[model samples]
Target: MAAVTETLPGAPTTGTGEGERRGRDRFHRGALRWVLLVVSAIVALLMIAPFVIMLLNTFKSPDDYSAHGPLSWPHEFYTHGLKVFWDRVDFPVKLWNSIWTSGLVAIFGVALSLLSAFAIGIGRVRGRLWIVGVFLLANMLPQEVLIYPLFRMMQDIGLNNSGWSIVLIFTVIQAAFGTYLLSSVLGTFPRALLEAASLDGANRWQILWRVVFPVVRPTLSVLLIFFFIWTWNEFFIPLVMLTTNDTQTVPIALASLQGDRMLDVPTLNAGTLVSLIPTLIFFLFFQRTLTRGITAGAVK
Candidate 1:
């Protein structure tokens, strides 16, 4: 009788409630997705708008550029501004100085950071936590606070007005973050393998270079890119340390174009457009290696 009642056509079906719930859930999810898409698109447009304006203004005639209506599109395009900017700026020397300095910062900064992190993370040294905490504290301090003292020290050592002074300064400042990051990486990997390397007649330095370094290469690549960008964009330290026309970096050279009044709108944009290209090219070239390193860390 119970079986016959359960099989009756008039009985309530459990699937009805489930189907209604699923319909509500699907509607909510669809609405949320659309909301996120709209927000993301708006943010992306805002970020890209400045660059678009810069590029458009680069081709505008100097007469068309006015303070009253700067954002308006030009009736005629001109190449004269770029030519003037290049002729005045000395692009080749500034570009070469920037390239080698940034490269040195990335390479030396990462190497120092790795060694510091290895000591703190792998060597199990006493007070490692305190040392790392100090580095973290130092990193948080503004560059402005440190620059004056650094300048004075450079003067004392007769290192002022030299390119090497700024390079060394950047390396030291950039290494702080690298040390913290690599330390985290060091803590995650197993130490037994490192121990085995040590026992197999490998010295501490050999184990670091031969064993631990290979494991952290991907993370190192990411750090290298970061150091390059940071050093390239730096202005204050370089301005203080590098005093001569012969030693100035790209930023200093561009800043030189600005006067007490009347900044060159079109030509300034053209110069900026020039300065940003190398950074763009660098990131594009190393994009894959960076992606893999970041993902590898996330997966682990």
Candidate 2:
């Protein structure tokens, strides 16, 4: 009979094959990470190139722009384009209207969405899933399809040609979205927290305002950023609703710079650049919240 052999405890079993496999895996991961980083950097540069060119054009003279090209760097930076566009567009009124309209949309729309989410997510009412399904359906419908009906409704309510008309339109459209995002966060909210609050004598509304709102403020900030940017850049709603120059938002005013009689590239570029600045600044401030807010609703 062959001699019996025993393997000892706490002994490292070495294998060249296993070691090679692990080394290969590490190599593959490192290569993939570097590849993705390079790809992302290329895409970022591509997106930034247009804005950089637009910025360069903002300072160049119209005569130089025509002689040279949009891609050409400015020989001398000047404020002529900025001043000309600002004066021509009646920017003060447009800026004011934009601030109020977008602000109203972000504030009121987010509030309504939060309350609705609280009822559906935290309240745990009957048919909550059905309610969520309806909201999802509404969100899926194209804004274009709803625009005509909304326009008619605004007309009937005598809000046509008013800034509130645009405000209301943005609120209605964005509220569905805010509800969707907030509900995802609230749905997963700890029931124990709500119960504890109730045990502490807090009412439902108080629980929502005190407990829920504080927890979901990150998501709320993300939603506010989204609403503000969309409203700021919104053209179709304002175009259909706002009749006169006085009621027009910054986007509409910037668009007015594009005339059929004469194409003022420098002024138009300057206006475009100006319109983008607020949004860029806003994102720079709130960008950290963006990643967290988007993922906070999802699982760990």
Note each model's CA RMSD in angstroms.
3.5, 5.3
lDDT of 2 by residue, 210-258 (tens): 9988888877877888998888988877888898988999999987888
- Candidate 1 stretches with Cα past 4 Å from truth are 1-14, 156-158, 199-201
Tens-digit per-residue lDDT, 140-223, candidate 1: 999899999999998998888987787888898889989987887787668789878878999988989899988888889889
- The Cα error of candidate 2 at residue 120, in Å, is 1.6
What lDDT score belongs to each candidate, Candidate 1 first?
A: 0.87, 0.87
Indicate the residue-level lDDT of 237 in model 1: 88
* Positional deviation of residue 219's Cα in model 1 after best superposition, in angstroms: 1.5
> Cα deviation in Å at residue 203, candidate 1?
3.2
lDDT score at residue 263, model 2, on the 0-100 scale: 87
